[model samples]
Target: MTHPRPPRSVLSRLRSQLVVSVQADDGSPLRDSRIIAALARAAEVGGAAGLRVRSAGDVRAVRAVSALPLIGLTKTWRTDTEVYITPTPGEARELAELGCELVAFDATRRPRPHPVAEMVAAIQGSGALALADVSTLAEAEAAMADGADVVSTALSGYTPNSPRQEEPDFELMRALTAAGIPFFAEGRLRTPAEAARALDLGAHAVVVGSAITRPDDITRWFAAALRDAAERTVSPVTEAL
Candidate 1:
């Protein structure tokens, strides 16, 4: 059976644009779908061209609140494997059925219940493009071969095999570009300059999350910076004492 091509309007609309990831952690105060919807609306008003939302309920909430393109995903933990992002075909299919334009799934080399190709086929069968969340160039290549429509640099630092970095993984972006793989710059993109730099490094687009949606994370970033500054400015005599 053949599936129709993903909506071109969505794909074209997201090109060279900012896709905000509005996700609240497990214990976050703003974990409710209503809050997420408000955040999505705020992002749209603030010029975000698209949204990368987690959970089917969140996707539906965001979709109801904005006309922006939506990329949906689910984070599930399993003791058997490390591939938590959309780990199963059922999750991918459900997200697609929620009217998301794209469904993001883990396309890494980690152990998973379903093959990456099966997940991709499931998303396409539901009329959504499959965006592969990859950590390495090899994973990206494999995802493409497995029929992923797009690759995102989402799992680079999360995976044990990929380099752990405080900043965006420009090396991975460069490698993907060199391999002629178009990808979305996603992980650790904390600033406008960093996002722009990713685009300059050949990212198809950029997705910003904690920096934009998680106020707690942003507050911590500021607090850490202030602490570092205070430590750096401390007097030599005080340090000696």
Candidate 2:
């Protein structure tokens, strides 16, 4: 049986929930496919509201394992491309083939491989919802102008900076509160407290990663602590030998 697509309720839950991006950037796991599946299933079992999967293979991996509604993103590097998620109508169609209910893409001031309106039309043409990943009011407005189903504050401080990754500015979130579309607080949210704060400020959803599903970062935290402790542990050279 086909699962029902995630509704606006997912947006509402995003206010205080974590949507795990279980897939890696390479679109292939260094481990096994079952590892990704277990991670996604564990997230859902542990109360994650949804899954934001990258790549078609990762989507396929998670789809068979977890019943969580998926928000799919396909990352293709095109020389002329500035946007990644469903950058073209073909990518959008690919998302639908993989059973993505909602497709997200960059809706910034930069040029997109596929124009915003045309992309929206294509997703609509395919009967899937479109999500606008924007960083500012103007971008959000432009996406709304293009008929986006939901507006996300995901890429807010990344692009236009060039070379450095910055956190989402609180001012942008404040500005987005009045945009008349569902507001999703994404990127760099470090803890559950921050998630609560975003929703309290009227955000529709808050997408968090690194802190949850990315064990590499978390493991580094532990490794650094061990390194520091090891440094502090003094032993007589002869005894140690």
Candidate 3:
């Protein structure tokens, strides 16, 4: 089937800008669609060039409140396969039909229910650009070859084969840049400086998630740091002894 080509203007709007991922973890108090919509509006007010939203319900909610370009996906856990992000073509089509400018899907080498080309076609066929979330350079290359419009370093640390680290996958970004693959810098980018650094490293755009929207995770990070610092404090009594 000949699909309507995804508009190039949507990509132009995202270049060198921040795309806040406004998703709440399962069971979080902020999981409500109303709260997600509010957070999306806040991100827009803060000048986010776009938004990366999860789930069809949240996408509809955010779409209702904001006009920024949306990169949409569904994080459904299937016992049959580990590829959760928009694992099915039906899910990808739904996101595009719901008005997402781009649809993101897991593009890793892990066994999946569907082929990468099929997923890309689904997104493009529904009139949205395909954003392949990849863990390694090989996956990005494969996804591009499979007709993905762009790739993101969103799954770099999540996959077992990729480097596991506390910080964002700068190494993967560098590899992508060196190989001349267009990609978005995502995953564990915690600060504005890091986001700026991503732009400096040849990323098409930067996608920030937990640092901007997951308040519970942010609070835990701070709490853990404080606890470690308190443990390391050298008391005067100890010094004297």
Using TM-score as the measure, the top candidate is 3
- Residue range 1-241, candidate 1, lDDT tens digits: 3456567677777888999999998899989999999999999999999999999889888888898888999999999998899999889888887888889999999888899999999999988999999999999999999888889999999888899879889999999999999799999999899999999998888999999999999999999998999888988896899
Which runs in model 2 stand beyond 4 Å of their true positions? Answer: 1-16, 27-32, 161-166, 220-241
- lDDT-better candidate, 2 vs 3: 3
User: What TM-score would you give candidate 2 relative to the actual structure?
Assistant: 0.81
- Please give the TM-score that candidate 3 achieves against the real structure: 0.96
TM for every model, in the order presented, reads 0.94, 0.81, 0.96
The weakest ten consecutive residues by lDDT in model 2 span 161-170
- Over the full model, what C-alpha lDDT does candidate 3 score relative to the true structure? 0.94
lDDT of 3 by residue, 151-189 (tens): 999999899889999998898899999999999999999
Candidate 1: regions farther than 4 A off: 1-5, 234-241
lDDT of predicted model 2: 0.73
- The worst-scoring run of ten residues by lDDT in candidate 3 lies at 1-10
Q: Against the true structure, candidate 1 has what lDDT? A: 0.91
lDDT of 2 by residue, 170-222 (tens): 56677788656676787777678877777776677677767778777768778
1 or 2: which has the higher lDDT? 1
Q: What are the candidates' C-alpha RMSDs?
A: 2.6, 4.3, 2.2
